[model samples]
Target: GGGSSSGGGGSSSGGGASAPAPGPQQPSRPAPGPAPAPAPAPAPAPSGNAAQVAISFAKAQLGESYILGGAGPNVWDCSGLVMMAYGAAGIDVGSHSVSSQYNTMQARGRLVPFSQRQAGDIIFWNDGSGFYHDAISLGGNTIIAAPKPGDVVKIQGLWGGSDIMPYVGRPG
Candidate 1:
């Protein structure tokens, strides 16, 4: 009878041993502490200004080829580049056409005088009959554009002439 009682006591201790197994795993959970470090990395992107975020996205595409209607991960057109840049910042300018983008900005009351333009403003151009080209302003007199077919996206001095629209679109 004493041997039977001892056997029962040994079984109870086996259950106690299982509890310690989770104790060892508690230390492994601390390894996930470093995982939170990466969480803060994505925080800055959200806190940064939208215009700056769009500018950064456009700058990354410099040297990519230009296609007449491309809106892409590689090639882009004038309005397409402007569209995707602001799209990266979570602002939708609508359509891949310069005229449509200008109208969208106007409808949203985002049009500002060209003299008040700042970085990330969408600058449109009217060659003669209608709004035809667009680009993202880099502040001052520089702009990033995917000018015409066969050319690559590049930052160049802002074009000044009768063709430039009087106002620039400031998408939030």
Candidate 2:
């Protein structure tokens, strides 16, 4: 019944945690003495320290061209640059468009009334219509952002009509 292995019977003599018999087919190249204990799986990347890595990467790409919604080593839009920068830290931001990005952040917490934001958080804006807008927290007063078309990636003052603000996620 078992697939063509060199075992005499499909069944094993003992159930769980029994030592394997040295059969011709089950040939242990290292030869069975004491089987080495299985290695432990690697741990998940820490989402908390992830943002710091992304921020450091972004800082290096300061003068990159500003492409509308472009994520690149070349040109980049606001969200794209932020996403790419964060990506360097081994974090994946699932949204590209402003609203898509906003929804992803919203799934985390609230806006409008404004909440206290930490570094590596997200901010979304609605330009009166339902059109998307966004930015990332740089901590303190400045924010790392691709302000507009023709503008290089730069840190800008976060206020005025720039309604988009922080969606407090781990700064990884």
Candidate 3:
């Protein structure tokens, strides 16, 4: 009877020992100490004004070819150019879709009428289907965009059309 009781206690103690040991070990091990290494990732992240950085990066891609879904480094589409430009500035809108990009701006920034838009504002246009084109404003009524499938990234005058309700979004 005594042996049975001691065996039960020993079994429970053995299990409890491993469980608590691992729990403390996880926190005590160097695992958390090396966590500081990944902190540098956010350190080198884009730190300046988002619009300025985005505009600078977008302008640098002036001659890149336009592809329907390209995301830069050479080629880009309308929304892809906008996304990559902002991403380079450390403001990720998290998508390649024009509508989704617009939503991100709507959530993070304020809408500015076309008449009051400034350089670096994100301007949007309808692609016949709806508001499906995006560009980086260069102010003075010009914009940097990938245009269309056969075009290259270039600065062009903003389109004036009532059919397309063009709008501007200022980054935060």
Candidate 4:
């Protein structure tokens, strides 16, 4: 005999029908448990040392006179300043020509995204055909360079917006 199944109550004998072979038993489920804790967040990547050294070296040259192609101790041109800074950091960035520097960076270094450039990365400006100017990043949107013949090596805000600095290269 079988009766309609009742919740939590065993089948009851009623109209003389054999209770459907007791259906397969289900294992008991544990009572509700607490939710699992979330996973920890990932850590940031380690920035390297050469970049900081390059920035420091560049800053120390501030107030030095600008010359057409000056490269060192007392005077500097745009690309010259950048080259010497990277040299101080122990990276050879090739010669003091803007075009040469651009080629070196493109071949050996990486083209950093315009928004992602950091201190010590080399910045290049294009003069229609190819790169014609460069500077050393001083972080915080500032740079140090020998801007022009009459200007001294100095710290200046990034000028001409992002279009001017079409390329940023990391020398590592």
| CA lDDT scores, all candidates in order | 0.83, 0.63, 0.75, 0.77
Alpha carbon lDDT of residue 155, candidate 2?
A: 71
Candidate 1 TM-score over all chains jointly:
0.71
Which of candidates 2 and 4 is the stronger one according to lDDT? Answer: 4
The most accurate candidate by TM-score is 1
The Cα error of candidate 2 at residue 171, in Å, is: 6.3
Q: Model 2, 61-148: lDDT tens per residue?
A: 6777888868887788877876787778775665667666566544543332235665555556666677454567677556677768
Cand. 2 Cα-lDDT:
0.63
Could you tell me which residue pairs clash in candidate 1? none
Question: Highest lDDT, which number?
Answer: 1
TM-score of candidate 4 against the unseen true structure: 0.68
Q: What is model 3's C-alpha RMSD?
A: 12.8
What total of clashing residue pairs does each candidate reach? 0, 8, 0, 1
How are the candidates ranked when ordered by TM-score, highest leading? Answer: 1, 4, 3, 2
Give one digit per residue, the lDDT tens place, for model 1 in 1-172: 4554333545344354534455345533455445543332121122238789888998999999998889989999999998898889888997889999999988877788899888878889998789889998889999999998999999999875889999988886
Q: Estimate each model's TM-score.
A: 0.71, 0.64, 0.67, 0.68
Q: Could you tell me which residue pairs clash in candidate 4?
A: 1-17
